[model samples]
Target: MADTNAQEDFSKLTADLAVLRADVAKLADTLTTLARSQGEAAADAVSSRVRQGKAKAEATASELMDEGRAAYDEARERAGKIGGDVTAVIERNPLGAVAAALGVGFLIGLLSRGR
Candidate 1:
């Protein structure tokens, strides 16, 4: 009777262990699937953010380039007007312009000799 009872108890313990192992395996698989899903979601979010940032950067660069071009055009126009005014003055007073040029050359030569 003792031997028979021990054998029955051993069989029950073995069955319980097998069920526990199956449950653990199911839990592991569930955790693996959850981790994979979360990782994919995070990757997708990062990719979306990167695309938005790139587009914003490109737009900002384009706007800055347009502003720079406008500034350059305005400066060029001002310089051209100033140059025309100077040329008209020089043409109207050729002898005075020659005297001014000779004065500037004398001053530059004097300064350069000191250097």
Candidate 2:
């Protein structure tokens, strides 16, 4: 009778171990699925952030380009006006313009002497 009882306990223990193994397998599957889902979510979030950053950079670049164009246009207009004024002055006093040019040339020569 004692041997029979020991045999029964051993059987029960084996069955319990099998059940625990199955439960562990199920848990592992659940954990793997959860990890995969979380990874996907993280990747998606990163991709979204990258897209947003790209858009922002593009927008900033576009704005800078527009500003550069505006600055170029303004500078061109100012240069044209200054050129017209200089032309008027040179026409009004030709000898004075020549004298000024000679003086500027002399100054430039002195400054560039070391080079």
Candidate closest to the true structure, highest TM-score: 2
**Per-residue lDDT over 48-75 for candidate 2, one digit per residue giving the tens place of the 0 to 100 score:** 9999999999999999999999999999
Give the alpha carbon lDDT tens digit for every residue of 1-115 in model 1.
9999999999999999999999999999999999999999999999999999999999999999999999999999999999999899999999999999999999999989954
Against the true structure, candidate 2 reaches a TM-score of: 0.93
Q: Superposing all C-alpha atoms, what RMSD in Å does each candidate have to the true structure?
A: 1.7, 1.5
Highest lDDT, which number? 2
**Candidate 1 local distance difference test against the native:** 0.97
Whole-model lDDT values for every prediction? 0.97, 0.99
